[model samples]
Target: MKAWEIQESFGISHLVQVERPDPTPGPYEVVVKMTAMSLNYRDLMMVTGRYNPRQPLPLVPLSDGVGEVISVGAEVTQVQPGDRVAGCFFEHWTCGKPSREALKSSQGGPADGMLMTHKIIHENGVVHVPAYLSDEEAATLPCAAVTAWNALFTEGNLRPGETVLCLGTGGVSVFAAQLALAVGARPIVTSSSDEKLTKLQALGISAGDCINYRNTPDWEESVLSLTDGVGVDHILEVGGAGTLEKSLACVRFGGNIYQIGILAGVTKDMSVIPILRNRVRVQGIYVGDRQSFDAMNAGIAQTKIQPVIDRVFDFEEAPEAFTHIEAAAHVGKICIRV
Candidate 1:
């Protein structure tokens, strides 16, 4: 088996590919031959040693991937050889509330991830993928797509005809937009680039529904205007402290703000007045459990939703893929064909 590792140091240039003995499955385990992988902002941070400086070195660094089941242990009955599956971000989080034990099983950082030609995982840690999606598309689901689904549907309880405010054109935001459209909800997406905003229009978002944040600095006010002063029913707030104030200002009373990331900044001197005043519900969403992943796959299969992939690199170009994501130029997910 071959895999890329962040050996001895953290940085994209330091990623080194090496070989290891192929894995054998234990009882209740399965061996998957990875076909594709995708990049997330967290993956870039992990490689650069910013996500968790205490994380051990020589880690395989990607949480999202899809593969074919080449072998299974004697007791494994959830899936069989030749089945297509996507690895779960948190291998032990099968259902219900997350716990310390479940958090320890998170892939691509604290644990070895699926960046290799072959990976051995518990049968409970992988989900059957939608039949209609290509390997590259299905590979983007583990982290970003599941987080979006958990935020919007599982926690937010997004209803049809309600408005959703997507912060940017990143994987989670774009997936939230697509999922919103799939369920008959309205999506208003904001981007720093007009070019990216134009590209989003092709993905079912209309020009009137897109906001160029560079041109409209007070985009939250624009969101309010678009909603006829009532404000949106749900918000995918990825910008943390730097944008939370504005997010609070635009979300309707009793509306849900699913906090999924801290892309802007982790700390800021912001008021929490609106939170209580407006009776808003701000929930922090981690990636989600296996039951939710299964439900999301079912929706994707029924709706024929296609994940937005910006680029695909060859297996040997893994380091280049990391560099590309570090540049933050992609409109959506960046993938690697393993």
Candidate 2:
């Protein structure tokens, strides 16, 4: 089997293609032949040494991909040889709360990930993709989609007619918007690019609901104005310390702020007074578990929500995929055909 690895260094330029022996399934294991893979911002950070500078070297770095089961151990019953599946972000996190042990099982960093021609996953770590989705679409589910799902449904407990503030046009944000629409909730999206904001209409965002952050630096005011000074009920806060202050200002009293990303620097001087004064709930969301993934798939199957793909790169152009994501020009998910 062939795979891409971060060989003895951390950068897109350091990624090298190499050959590895095909893996065979052990008891309760499944071997999948990867068909398509998707890029997450975390993947870019891991490669560039920003996510975890201490992460081990020579690692296959991606948590999202879809493949056909080519083999299964005798004890495996969850999936068969011909079933299409996507690997879980945390191989051992099947249900319930996360723990230190479960966190260690995360792929693409401490564990070897799904950036190869074939991968061996525990039978419990793979979930069947929705029948309606294409392989490329299914590949985008493991991380970003599940994170958005966990934030809105599992943590936020979002109700219909409530307003959701999506930080950007990234995968998780877009997924949240689609999910919000599916549940009869309203979503207001923000992007630095007006073109991207215009493109969001295809996903059901209205021209008035989209905010160009570049033009409106204090976009939190816009959010409050749109909601008639009550503020949004939920916020997908991806900008980390850089935007958390603004998020605090715009979220309604007792609203939920699901912190999922740190795209805009990890550290900054900020006050915690607003959090207490507003009685807001700030939760840190790390993807999700298999139970949540299953629930999300069920919802997707029902809603027939198609994942937005900005571009698809050939297997040989894997490095270019990283480059494209770093440029941040995409409004949706970026994929690679394996």
Candidate 3:
């Protein structure tokens, strides 16, 4: 089997194609023929050696993938041959409390990921993709969509008629905006590009009001203005350290802020006075567990929410897909056909 591997902990350029023996499933595992995989910001961090330092060398490089079951091992009955399935990002986190052990387990790290021609996944970690979605669409659900789902519903408890603020037009933000709308909550999406905002409007998203963050660096005030000085009910914070303060400013008193990503520089400092004054709850979100993933898939089936895919690359163009994401040029999911 051909898989993309990071030859060394250098950068994206270090990613190289390598041949590995095709894997056979253990008694509780199933082997899948990968159809598609999607990229996430963490993948970039892993490539650059900026994520967890414990990540092993020569690691397989993606956590989100969808495939069809080709063969099953002895005790595997969760899925059979020909069933479409997507592997969980946190392979060991089936449900309940996430411990350090579960957090350490993931595909595309010391554990093999699905960026190859075939992947073997433990039956417990594989979830059936929504019947309505194609392989390309289903591939985007594992990490990005699940993270958005956890951020909005699990952490924020966003309600209908409440206003939610999503920063940037990344995969998580886009999915969060759509989910908010599906639940009757209003979404305010910010972008550096006006053109993208127009496209979002065409998709029936009012966007509350679009702010060109590049133009107005203090866009938090704009969010305040839109909320009639009350601030938004929830904020999906993707910018991490760089945007945390502004996110605090834009959230309403007693509101929740889901901190999901750190696309900007990592280290940050903030005064606790604002959080104390507003009584805000800040929650850090991992991708989520199987139950949450299943709930998100159900919502996708019910609403038929289409993911915004910026581009698709051939299997051979996987490196280019990574490059596109690293450049921050894509508006939504960047997929690779395998």
Candidate 4:
């Protein structure tokens, strides 16, 4: 087996491809021949020694992947050889609320990720990919897609005709927009670039629905105007402290704000009294549990939803993919085809 390991050092330049012995499955585990993987902003932080400075070195650094089962252990039953599946971001969070133990088992950092040609994982840690999606598309689901689904349907309980405000055109934002459309919710997307905003319009978002935050600095007010001053029903607030205030200002009373990222500035000061006075819900959404992933997959299959992939790099070019994502130029998910 061949894998990219963050050897003795902690930086993208230190990622090295090396040969390793193939993994043998435990009684309840399976071996998958990984076919594709996707990059996340966290992956960049992990490789650059920012996500967790003490994260042990020599780790594989990606959370999302799709693969084909090639072997199953004697007691494994949920999946079998030849089945197509995507790895769960949290291997142990099968259902309900996440536990401390489940967080320890999250892939890409504490666990050996599926950035290689082969991987061994518990049968309970994989979800069958939708038949309508290709490996590259399904590979984007484990982190971004599932997080968006959990933020909206699982927590937000998004309703048709209700409005969703997605902060930007990143992977989670794009997936949220697609999932909103799939569920009949209107999505108001904001991007720093008009070019990126226009690109979203090509993906079935009406020009009226895309807001250039650069042009409209008070984009939250634009969101309010778009919804006739009632404010959006939900806001996918990934920008953290830097944008949390505006998100709070744009939400309807009792609306939910799904806090999923710290891409903007983690240390910036922001007010919290609005969350109390407005009775707004600020749900902290980690990736998601396996049951929710299955539920989201079912909806995805029915809606024939296609993940918006900004670019697909060959497996050997995984490092380049990291650099591309670091540039923050992509409008959606950046993938590595194994």
For candidate 2, the per-residue lDDT at 47 reads: 94
lDDT of each: 0.93, 0.94, 0.87, 0.91
Candidate 1 local lDDT, 1-338, one digit each (tens): 99999999888889999999999999999999999999999998899999999998889999988999999999999999999999999999999988999999988989999789999989999999999999999999999999999999999888999999999899999999999999999999999999998999998887998998889999999999999999999999988888899999999999999988989989999888999999999999999999999999999999999999999999999999998887777888999998
Q: After superposition, how far is residue 79 of candidate 1 from its true place, in Å?
A: 1.0
All models, RMSD in angstroms:
0.7, 0.7, 1.2, 1.0
lDDT of 3 at 167: 87
In TM-score terms, candidate 1 sits at: 0.99
lDDT tens readout by residue for model 4, 188-245: 9999899998888877877898898888899989888888888889999889888999
In candidate 3, which residue pairs get closer than 3 Å at backbone N, Cα or C atoms, i.e. clash?
none
Clashes of 3: 0
Model 4 regions lying over 4 Å from their true place: none
lDDT of 3: 0.87
Of the two candidates 3 and 4, the one with more favorable TM-score, higher being better, is: 4
TM-score of 4: 0.98
Which pairs in model 2 have colliding backbones? none
Query: What's the residue-level lDDT of 291 in candidate 4?
Result: 97
**lDDT value, candidate 1, whole model:** 0.93
List model 3 lDDT by residue over 1-338, tens digit each.
88888875658788888888988999999999999999988887777887767677878888999999999999997899999999999888999889888876787765767789899888988999888887888998899999999888877677899988888888898898889888999889899888878777765677557788998899999999999999999888889889999999889999988888887666777787888899999888888998889888888899999988988888888889888998886777989998
